[model samples]
Target: MRNLTVIIPTYNQKDLLERAINSLISKCNDEINIYVLVNNTESNYIVRNKNYANLHVEYLNTNCGFCKAVNYGLRLIKKSRFIFLLNDDTEVINQIDIDNIIHELIEKGNIFSISLKMLKGNYPNLLDDAGDMYTILGWQFKRGNGLPKELYDRPCEIISACGGAAIYNKKILDEIGYFDEDFFAYLEDVDLGLRALMRGYKNLYYPYISVLHVGSATTGGKYNDITIRLTARNSIYVIYKNLPLPLLIINFPFILLGYLIKFIFFAKKGKGKIYISGVLEGLKNLPKFKEKRRENMRKKKISNIKLEWILIKATFEYFHQYIKRAFYTLRGAKK
Candidate 1:
């Protein structure tokens, strides 16, 4: 069986898709199968492109959003033991030795996924995402984002792996479950990773494997209405689904504070109303969320304290970054 199957999901970005496909084709060996899910785009667009000749293309008639697109691609592949999820806006920067990585994963038995170092496309010297970090306050952030690349040169455990450029053990995914389609887009990776963690699976951040990502290529660049809405809504779902009832009761205050702070921050960015709308939408779907939460609870293998230990706390550094960003934005506005 082939060791790796790379799944790239694209919405309407044909040019970026071509670049991503070519980069993977050049960097990866022939043993690795690449599947491109052309979601919500006209069939003729892919059919006319000769660039897709070497890659497997699965065309979706309707715009099913990111989560569904990935799940669709996963359904199409059968043989590969490891599945690598890549965003269509990313380019493989180096030749990733799949055999070595697979060996490492096998040796590490508990690791469900390995988060690859994602460098910024515009500034390769800076890091885009080292891995994903989750906090007790029901928030998720990309670790080492905008930091110097050398800062995160060591492998470590992370709360989650970014789906943009992460390798997952296919069996674990089958066990824990695929990305929640209800998420539609943002925070789905965190939701999935958290589920894996609750099921006794670990996620690792491997610095050797890297990719350049042109983030927010599908939705308008970060902090836009669409992204703000989807992310805010999904955040609620993630917290609801993963935390047990007792844990949820204990963390409710922190969760409320987090959402309040986020509302104020996004409001300053002129997305407050949109963000609130998403939050309300999430609350409106509580019945569905509760049902899913019950189902997820059944798969729990770890204690709440153990899971909490893995998550980070709301430290001064976290608030400090936001303060700095707000300061910079105000300064830029004055100029």
Candidate 2:
């Protein structure tokens, strides 16, 4: 039984994929296994040149979405205590000790999932997010979004994280279920993290290990109409499925206000009313999400009040004001 199984799910980002593979091949400390699932539709791309002569690399027969591709690899690996669902566009920069992460897991004995410190490529002061967080409303966000790199060293509990890079306890995943395949791309991590919290598990952000993220490499910075629609629809799914009564009451106005502001911003940016389109798609699927949530609540004895703080952090949209102010401070403090 090895300590970890590092899985990277990729589609069409060959250049970044090569760089990420080299970074991991260089820094891993123990005899851990590496699994890379190529989810590309076309027959070939010549993705691996690493000379990983000692690692495991597999390709799915068909191109499944992000969640399903990783799960395919999981079905192959027999035994791993911890599973690292890493992104193909991120690079591990430090010689992270797997023993330390495992030891911390034993010591805490409670945390179910986490993400390493994520610094944006070539922008040391800017953070991709130490981990993911949100409010009760349908606004999923990153922790320390524009905060200085120094603040990332602090370890804390977070609502959820960008699935691009995060660690999960295999046992916990089995308990709660795999990433909701319906969320083909965005907000899947948030949904999984929320499910665990609702069942009394904690998702944390750890800084002992660090990595550089080539953010949004696959979809580029912003997407075409389809990606935008999917993202909008999924964001609403997260809020609808995880929101509890108290936090919903407190944050409903904020959710509406946030989307209205986003609508104007997107319109000015020439993004064709995607905010409205996304909400409508979400509403059309609301009955499905509601049923899942009700079934989940029934199976787990924990009440929403016990998980209120997690809900608040999961839907935090108020942090944008802080982010704008902090970007200036970060620039001033940068070396």
Candidate 3:
């Protein structure tokens, strides 16, 4: 079996997709299989181009969101030991240390995944993401977003590896589950990571490997209606699917506060109504996510104390970075 299979999910960005594929072809070993899972795009965009040796394209007629696109690729290449999920808008900036990543996965039996540090395109000092972070408040955020790239150089355990550019141990993923298709687009990685934790597996941040990312190239720069709706709704899905009833009660107030803060923030952006609709949509679908929680309960391996502490640490770090980012913005303004 091939040791690694790379899946790049794309939606309507033909030129950028070419760049991402070429970057991998140049940097990665030709033996590694690369799957370009093309989501709703023109008929001949990918087909017209001459395919490379180890690269394959899977074309879809409908616009399946991130979760389904990735899941489809997983189904196609199920035997690979490690799977790397890369975003079409990203370019591999260095040779992927496949041996090191595989060694780490093998040496550390509990690690489910590893995130690659991503810097903003053309600005090596600016970070796209170090990893994904989750807090007790039901918030999932990108660690070290827009901060100096050097600030997040150390390796550490993260709440989740950003699905955009992370490597997963296919065996563990098969055991826990693939990305939840109900998520459709957002917060799905957090749900997957939480599930991994429940099964006593770690998700890590490995800073030695990196990529150049053009963030939000597919979903329209961060705050669009589509992203807002999906993120708002999926936040509730995350809390519902992972946290048991007791834990949910303990975190309720903080989670509510988080939602309120986000509501006001979106209100300022004229998306308040849209955000509320999304929340209502999530609440409406509670029964399904609750069932999912019950199904996952039997697999819970990590103790309650450790889980809570992980969230508490993430919450404090979130606020710490928030304050530091504000300070940096103020300093920049003064200059």
Candidate 4:
């Protein structure tokens, strides 16, 4: 068995998939195996491994979105010690970076997940997202997003996981679960981090392991209908699945208020209907989502403290700054 398996789940990105595959081929040391999961009917690239060994491809029959495609592909891999997830639009920019991540994973032993620094494809030097952060409203946001590249250098612990280029312990994941099939695509990483964190496992960010991602190249970018709906559904479903009854009570108001603000923003962009539909559909589907949560939380062997800490640690302070700024602006205007 290989020390690690790099799994890239793809859908309809025939243009960039070859570059992504080549990127992996360039970086992976002999210790890891590369697995590509493709679902789209259009297969673009072919891999001829004369120089490199341990690289494999598993093509699916239908376009099963991303979550199912990954899970489906994962089931076929001979259960390796580590499973690294990289997106079809992302490329490993550095080889030493990947080596460091594998080193950390092996040394840590109990780490459930580790995310790498993801930079935007347009501005390869500028930071796209450092890792994933959880917000108080029970949502995940990419850290250091839109910030200058020079600022994000230190490795740290993150509350949530980033699926763009994250490595997972396969054994732990199989028991905890794979990506929630209901999530289809977006927010699945956040849901997985929440579920795993609830079990006392560590999810971290290794800044040294950096990669570049062409954001939304395969899926939604600014805000399309499918992205809107799944994100909306999963956002509400996340709070339902992870938050306790009391935290849930405290979180509802903020969640609604956040959506209200988002609605106005979407309206300004002429996509108001899309956001509204997502919110409404998410609300309508809450009961079933809640039941899913109830069933999932039962499988964990962690304390409620760790669960709450997951929320607190994963909490992104950036939004708190914006909210604070907004409140002060309102107060100053009143004064």
Candidate 5:
């Protein structure tokens, strides 16, 4: 049985997918199987991997989107102890980084996932993401996004692993369930992380384990109508699915404020309508999340107060970063 299996989900970037696969084949051991989920694409596009023995490809005729594609791939894997979700637009930087992540996973049974650090493609000095962070204000952001790569050199706990490149323990995933298909794409990883947290499992960021990621190769550039709609809609889904009744009511105002701010931001970018539509859609389908809410509530091992504290702390961290950025921007303007 394979100890680790890397799942790469691709939409139409055949070249990028091949590059990713080749990078892994060269850097990783031949024993590590690579499963490529070609979403809405022909399998013939991928050139035969004669050199790599453990490569597998699954072709989907319809565009099932990211969540469903990943879950579909997950369901097929019965032997792997760990599942590494990687984007087609990313390349493994070094085998040692992956080895470190595997070692960490083997050492820690309570860890649900390890989010590998990503350097922006072609700009190796700039950080793409360290890990994912969530706030009570219903905002999810990358922990070390757009910062210097050198700034984040330590491992730490995170709210979620960025789905682009992360290693998840199969056991924890089995216990907490896979990505919520209702999300279709956005914020689904955050929902998974919240479920793990509620079940007393820790998600981590290991900065030493890094990848080179060309962000958003499939969904167009970030802030497109599709991204805006799915993100807006899925944010609501995450909030609804994870929070219990009383906590939801308590955090309602902050969440509303977050949405309001996001609406204004996107409105300035001419995506306000798309954002509102997503939110409305999410609200319309709120009933669909009822079972998820009950499930999380039932399996919740962490105290309500602790969960609130986690969100509150993450919120404070967000504000601190916001203020720091604003200060630096002003300083640069003066310069």
Candidate 6:
């Protein structure tokens, strides 16, 4: 197998970050290089303490968020052809066949990214993310999240690979460009994956490679003010930056409806004000996103019809799933 670089972006979670690095070191051979991008911190504990043959660490004085940190790491790795992005909160529980996966990637010419089977660390039986899926309403979801592990038994093609524990071909990033720094964090993976799709590249969900992720470890556990605000804000940017003008116009109603429903749902959780603030921020940055949209569209190799086929046709199905999950959560709270 060709030499691979694993980039782990971490914030203030030094203990968890150390554990994550140790897990990789245990499983990875000398051929694998681990790059830990310590974002916005002065902590040199990991750099000083962990002494491995292939480990390297870099620190950024300013907090640049997940997107920028990963991009910075990509720029730093000059030797490796394959790059794997892993979350600092994740742990590698099983043995990985890196050579076999690399061979599979070579065999599949169109594949630019591979999504690994990520199981929730807390609940070993449940999945954290199988891959990522995009809807016509401009929503991106974690495929098979919180579901039984046995459900996803086969390898298949997916719309996008989750940035938490996915591998990417360097050539694809060179062509389609890196993660949008403006995204900061949320939905940025979807934006990159969508861009890859537009440029006639494919993403695959490889069930063979696996990891354990403690979801949302850095951002205060999924639905906090920061998470909601950034997610709401970046969601708009993704829609504007990726879709063609015609498709954007066609999907406007559905997008509006989706936001409306999201507002109501978050309101139930007392996050309506934060969510609305994010929407306003997103709307204010429309001009910036429009420029990005124009830049991305110029590189399109796939037609709107072909892209439409890949997108989820019925947007309501996702909403239904959300409502069902919410209902169960509410019921459990009452119980």
Scored by TM-score, the top model is 3
Off by over 4 Å in 1: 47-54, 313-335
* Alpha-carbon RMSD of each model: 3.2, 2.8, 1.6, 4.6, 1.9, 2.7
lDDT of 4 by residue, 121-163 (tens): 8888667877777766555677777665667788777766688
Candidate 4, lDDT over the whole model: 0.74
lDDT tens digits by residue: candidate 5, 122-171: 77887888888899889998876666688789988888999999989987
> lDDT tens string, model 6, 1-335?
24578999999888888888888777764457888899877655555334676778888878899999999999988877889899999988877767777887744588899999999998877778888888887778887676668877788778789999999998778777899999899899999998998888889888876788998898988899999999999998888888898888887887888899899999999999999999999989989777678878998999998787677542454566567557756876899
- Which has the greatest lDDT? 3
Give per-model TM-scores.
Answer: 0.91, 0.89, 0.96, 0.88, 0.94, 0.92
Rate residue 106 of model 3 by lDDT.
Answer: 45
- Give the Cα-based TM-score of candidate 4 against the true structure: 0.88
- How do these models rank on lDDT, best leading? 3, 5, 6, 1, 2, 4
lDDT per residue, candidate 2, 151-224, as tens digits?
66878787775577788888878878888877777788888888887777888888877788877677676556
- The runs of at least 3 residues in candidate 3 whose Cα sits more than 4 Å from the true structure, single-residue gaps closed, are 47-51
> Which ten residues in a row are the worst by lDDT in model 1?
46-55
Clashing pairs in 2: 134-313, 134-314, 134-315, 134-316, 135-314, 135-315, 135-316
List candidate 2 stretches off by more than 4 Å: 41-43, 46-54, 223-226, 245-250, 313-335
Better of 2 and 5 by TM-score: 5
- After superposing all C-alphas onto the true structure, candidate 3 shows an RMSD in angstroms of 1.6
Candidate achieving higher TM-score, 4 or 5: 5
Clashes (N, CA, C under 3 Å) per candidate: 0, 7, 0, 1, 0, 0
List per-prediction Cα lDDT, in the order shown. 0.84, 0.75, 0.87, 0.74, 0.85, 0.84
Cα lDDT tens digits, model 1, 243-299, are 888878887888889899999999998889999999999888878877778888987
Clashing pairs in 1: none
lDDT of 5: 0.85
Better of 1 and 5 by TM-score: 5
